[model samples]
Target: MKRFLSGFLIGTAATVAAAASVVLTVKKQVIDPIDEQQVAHDEKRKRAMRKSAAR
Candidate 1:
């Protein structure tokens, strides 16, 4: 019983750690680039609007 409990706890911890790392990696690789692109696009759109307004 003790051995089984220990194994279960260890497995749970490892799964949690792996899930956290995957989330972090996805945020770094995917979310960050998408966010950066959106920011740049918004800035460009704002600039275009201002230019048209000026004209």
Candidate 2:
């Protein structure tokens, strides 16, 4: 019973680690780019607004 419990815990930990790794990778590969683009877009919009307001 002890061995089985230990194995189960180890497996659970490994699964959680794998899931975390996948999430991080996805965030880096996919979400980060989108966030960067959004920031760039927002900056561009702000610049445009400022330019219009200046006129």
Ten contiguous residues with the weakest lDDT in model 1:
1-10
Best-matching candidate per TM-score: 1
Tens digit of lDDT per residue, candidate 2, span 1-55?
Answer: 9999999999999999999999999999999999999999999999999999999
Per-residue lDDT of 1-55 in model 1, one digit per residue for the tens? 9999999999999999999999999999999999999999999999999999999
TM-score of 1: 0.92
In model 2, which runs have C-alpha deviations exceeding 4 angstroms?
none
Q: Can you give the lDDT of residue 31 in candidate 2?
A: 100
- Residue-level error in angstroms, candidate 2, position 39: 0.7
